[model samples]
Target: MDTDAILALLDGQYLLILGAVLLIIALVAIIKLRGSVHQLGQEHDQLTRRLDTLWHDLDAMHQDDTPSLSGKSKAPTTSATPDTSPELLLAERRLFEGLWPVAWALHDKVGGFLRAVESGDPHSESRLAARNAALEMRSQINRSRPFFDAEIEGILTQLVDIEIKAHLTACQYLDQRQSNLGVSSEGSDVRESYRNKWRQLYDREANELINHLVSAMRKRLVRHVP
Candidate 1:
């Protein structure tokens, strides 16, 4: 072949090689991008589910207007005559009215946290709302600190710990689930391990702790005559 013709043929071969390399690079980029898009879709779907669950929980709490934890549905009516001892009367009123509602509020708060777990929704706002309500109840107890002695305070502290632990457990479970889902190579055994830890350790421990607090509180309150 002539010199110019040989050089032209070499140029054509170089162009073909370069085109192949570019095509391979484009395919790899597309694959990576598709995987990312799929991941984003999954994340969006999970968030949407969480939001829906939170809305449902809020609706349920709003609907349940009946008093909880209190033994009676309505307060007993008294004669028009007022009590002679104002202090005793106030204590009596608090025993009947304040304490029961506070207990019920705590119960409701726990129930809400459990429901959020059942729903598998970690909507921050819903969890925050429940936490804030629990805090308010805690504040009320603190304000009435003198009424409850050392033993009562200890039980209340235990109850607060239970509440805080429940929230932490739920958040940890959600985080683990999300992390497991993000990794493509994660094995079923790892997921199962997470489940076991949550069920056997986190949940069982929290349940036992809360039950202990409830029993302690009941025992302490039982001794009070007023």
Candidate 2:
């Protein structure tokens, strides 16, 4: 071939090679883009599931806290009737009457303390009062342990346990919050979420236990009526 034709042929081959390189680059870019899109979709789905679980938890808490039309929160009621003598029934009723006030007071004080801590306004006085109320309730329960049936004793123990757990969780969250004050970090955010989750869980559990205790007490007292 002549030099001019040979040079033209070489240039055409170079252009074909350059086009092929560009096509490969475009394919690689397209694959990477699809991979990124898929990863983002998976992340979005995980976030959505977390949010749904959080919403369900909050809704359950709200339902537990709300009172029914009769000005009392709905709770499961026991239907069993007492089969004891009149004197025993009277004694049981009297004991329960004496214990109910302290039980309710303990619930109120612990609940108040938890609310204050969760709202970022933890008060030493409220915590102290709650501790005192718990002590008093414990003293009463111990003193009256002989008179309580197994079911009532179990409910009382659960109530105390729930109170202690709720109180401890609140204290831990408060301590964590104080330690992380003015320090904004990803680790702190994760810790905060963890503490909040535990606090809410304990609070919900406390409310449920109190409801169950109230139901048991009512069932016992209702047998005394008529």
Best by lDDT: 2
The models' CA-based lDDT, in order, is 0.56, 0.69
What shift in Å separates residue 167 of candidate 1 from its native position after superposition?
A: 0.5
Compose the digit string of candidate 1's lDDT tens values, residues 90-137.
574455356556655665665576566657666666667666665665
| Residues forming the 10-long window of minimal summed lDDT in candidate 2 | 65-74
Q: How far is 9's C-alpha from truth in model 1 (Å)?
A: 46
Question: How much is the lDDT of residue 81 in candidate 1?
Answer: 32
lDDT of 2 by residue, 133-211 (tens): 7667777877998887656766665566556555655656666666755266864775577566546545576577677
Query: Per model, how many backbone clashes are there?
Result: 0, 0
TM-score, every prediction: 0.45, 0.57
Q: Which residue ranges in model 2 land beyond 4 Å of their true spot? A: 1-83, 180-182, 194-202, 224-226
Q: Specify the highest-TM-score model's number.
A: 2
Deviation in angstroms for 82 in model 2? 6.6
